[model samples]
Target: MGLGKLLHDHAEHADVGGTIDHPRAYELAAEIGFLGRRREIFTRLAALSGVRPGDRVLDVGCGTGYLTRILAPIVSPAGRVTGVDASAPMVEHARRRAPGNCSYQVGEGQALDLPDAGFDVVVSSLAVHHIPAAERGAALREMFRVLRPGGRLLIAEFRPPTNHLLAQLVGMVSGPAMRHSPHDLLGDLIPAAGFHVQDEGDLPVMLSYVRALRPST
Candidate 1:
């Protein structure tokens, strides 16, 4: 079995790409996948999010709440960070590790059970490709729906290495879901969903990100 299959629970949500049920194992894999720089890379992601103190933030597909933990301090005391994932086990694991200002729930990204325009910022990482390919558009729309007008969004996804051999190796280990170039994976979804894309670029350790905002008007 590929490492992706090993870490995922295919039997649970067969319609969805794959739901990772083993939080501890997923955590270890993420650490190894990032080559011990998960924190550093995620910190940059948080910065790119343009989150401020007292800003209400939402994390979609927040596996194990790793990014939420990094964001907790920044939005602490007054602001809050809410994490949503499809897997109950993953949500439970994140709840255990959640800080006082952070909370978690079991929910789908394509059909979020959140109020419209409720969040100041919304971020999703390595989560879009996990949604069924047909539903990715809905998921991006949902992200736009939940964020207040003028709210910021940051989406980070795995960028396959440029080297052919390394890219094939990544595919073998992680499965086909991660093999897509971020541009192809995202396409015009952000703009189609009503987001004004601000910037996008590659990050170290094979990551790519797009920053966008909901128009205030």
Candidate 2:
């Protein structure tokens, strides 16, 4: 089976909980209200993204289309939101739930099929971490290539824990995820990808939202 198919199997009933056909994300993030913390994070991204009504947006690892659907309205009528994930089941769920303004496809994060500089904004929430540690920097590079000058890339990833309690808890719940933690300097890696890292910080405190912007000339 291809990687996509393998991913599909692992994701069976893996998503949060709602869609009977599609698996739920372990985060159970969609359970939150549309105007809740997610909205707040995206609002900040919108401002930093320079995502006007007519700019194209790319959603990397857009599971179940939560953030993708949210971005559609903001960039609608003129702009479009494209969601890409490797899991067929996840893509199906996203397609069913997504409005016509959005499109979902089964694809890999490191090797996006989209053309260069095609998007004005590139965003991923709690998704980039799934990529293998060695290729995450390449994934960011791909995002950079697809983003137009001044396009924005916002990623919310799990940061290294400060205490053993949080670490232990993370190990228990997301231990498998630990393999993807490369310990790379995300602050500097964003810049190394050809885009200056405009902002680097933890967001929502508990969620560890890491955000960066690439300015266009």
Candidate 3:
């Protein structure tokens, strides 16, 4: 795969925008040492998501289904978990790795093929930033639309370093597509999407976790 694939050129294609193929995606994961922390990160995201038994959950931008696998058993027996990503290769790999309760789809954050108010909890980790910064708000609204009344929304994003040097280093390693600056934007976008911001703080390492909820009607 080319560098553009890993960087995710959002302009070339409108709907399914990401370009990270299986090899490059996994290679990046290994390069960042994210593979080791994958389980821990997924656990934190799932806990913050407040996923309960029998709840329907959606994992947006569920690259390789690492988080989706962690979520399946939590909402098992009667619950269902669906993982979606813009990269077909990622989706394919995730499907191969998925459990009985989990499924994968090729989709984008800004426009999901799911129905309105269908999920009890919607979560994405280190994924939303792949969407173009200009269209992030729309993607947040899309997350909101799929969530049922009183459903939870949890997103795990990079906690940008306060130090300029470290920040630039992080940007360089994570790529230009990571310029969405989740910490700065999600605080506002979640509420604007009609979700009530419930909790926000650091997860482990460089990640920041935000938990929100759709108001019950």
Candidate 4:
């Protein structure tokens, strides 16, 4: 379908949930690049997650596969990288741009249908905030479920809004669900998801990254 149809489809679902589908998804991709945070955020996430040459990685909510592309080379010849998004259009778009070693699938963060204990690392960038407040915990638990014991999970998200005005603005642009995201409560959320917190810190423009691990038991 044409971009028009793609965008129309996105609009149909925009308010139903917090999805950046089609044209807006593409627009956000460009906007992040313009701010120079696109590359920086994913790079830092990769580093913080410590993805190695042979690690099997999953990029949850991997809209259009930008970060999946970045990870393909890092995992290199032996490793595999899979990118999954709830938006089928985004998954299709991502597949077009993905490398040979990278794969794209249609999936949801709150209930991934992937095999359990399969990936060595899972990274989600600025995506989970789109999940409704009530569903965010289930999403984190799914991320935990997909990782192998001792595997790593890294997430990059906007920090909690600094003021009521900013908070309101975030809700308008991102969604109401974002206000209740793990941004401010990572210390607790990560552990509740059955992860051991490894590191947490700020990124550019009110964004933050968290690194956690599934216990090796």
Candidate 5:
């Protein structure tokens, strides 16, 4: 079985990409996959999110609350960071490590339980491809719905390496989900969801990101 299949819970919807059940194993894999630069990379992601000290932030598919933990200190004192994931186990694991300003719940990206226009920022990292392809549009729409006008959004996804051998190796390990080019995976989804595209570019460590804003008007 591929590493992805090994880490994924088979009980989850077969149509969905997969939900990780083993938090510790997933954490270890993430650390290894990122080459021990997970913290620095995630810190950059948090910065790209355009979150402020008083901005309410939401993290969709927040595996192990890694990004949420990074965001908590940024949105400290008064602001709150809420993380939602499809895996109950992952949510529970996140809850155990959550900071004072962070919280977590079991939820899916396509059908968020959050209120409309409730968040100033929404960020999802390495999570979009996990949503079933049919539901990805709905998930983007949900992100649009939960953000206040002019709210920022940052989405980061895996970028397959340019080297053919390395890309194939990544596919073999992570499954087909990570094999897609971020541009092809996200094409028109953000704009179709009513977000104004701000910037998009490749980041270090085989990551690609898109930043957008909810229209103020």
Candidate 6:
């Protein structure tokens, strides 16, 4: 199959944004060389989500459904999990690799077809950087629209300049695509998009996270 078909097919399983070949969080999971770290991260995201029985869940930019599938059991039989991404191949891979309780959708972060207040939790990892810097805020607004009151947004990304020379150097070795993202700025942007920032933490310096909650209007 052609590259496009491969990517599309993968999107059927995971959340892939576009043709851009960017370094994803899975790469870190791979470097860890085990599902344990991935599972740990997924669990943290799920627990932080505050998902309850019968609560609908949306995994925005849910690459490979790692976190999305983990949420399936939390939401339980009554609740549902929808994973939206832009690539067919990623989504396809996610579908094949994930549990049956989760479903996948092909779409952009800036425009989701899901209804207003449709999800109890929306989490994305290493996806905001792939989107154009100008479009990141817009995409965040879209995430807000689909969330139910009291829903939470958790985003994890690599903070830059921790080792600026090292990152650029690694980019040189792994090619430009391996370069780190501007994870530092997201904390400020989250509130600007309307959510209330609840906590901000770091993961071994290179990775940082921001958690925000939507207050009932």
Q: Give the runs in model 2 whose Cα sits over 4 Å from its true position.
A: 1-22, 25-48, 160-163, 178-187, 213-217
How close is every model to the real structure, measured as TM-score? 0.95, 0.75, 0.85, 0.82, 0.95, 0.77
List the global CA lDDT of all models: 0.89, 0.65, 0.78, 0.76, 0.88, 0.67
Residue by residue across 1-217, what tens digits does model 2's lDDT show? 4322333334322221111123564324233312257667656655555567977899888877877777778887788999998777888889889888899898877899989999888987667656654666788899999998877887766565667676665544443333233234244556778776665556552344445667666
Q: Which of the two, 2 or 4, has more TM-score? A: 4
Task: Report lDDT (Cα) of residue 177, candidate 3.
Answer: 38
Better of 1 and 2 by lDDT: 1
Q: Model 5 segments beyond 4 Å from truth?
A: 9-16
> What does the lDDT come to for candidate 6?
0.67
Model 4 residue 142 distance off true place after TM-score fit, in angstroms:
1.5
* Best of the candidates, lDDT: 1
Clashes per candidate (backbone, < 3 Å): 0, 9, 0, 0, 0, 26
Q: Tens-digit lDDT track for model 4 on 37-87? A: 667766767778799999999998898887888888999989999988888
Q: What is the Cα-based lDDT of residue 130 in candidate 5?
A: 83
What lDDT does model 3 reach? 0.78
True-structure RMSD for candidate 1: 2.0
Which stretches of candidate 1 lie above 4 Å from their native place?
Answer: 9-16
* Sort order, TM-score high to low: 1, 5, 3, 4, 6, 2
For residue 19, what is the lDDT in candidate 3?
A: 50
lDDT of 6 by residue, 1-217 (tens): 4332332322221222243232243445334532246566557767766778887878777766677778888888888889987766567778887676789988878888888888888888656755555667888998889888888888876555456676664433222223445444453678877898898776543556788998887
TM-score of 4: 0.82
- TM-score for candidate 6, please give it: 0.77
Can you write out model 5's per-residue Cα lDDT over 93-174, one digit (the tens) per residue? 9999989989999999999999999999999998888888788999999999999998999999999899998777766556
Candidate 2 TM-score to native: 0.75
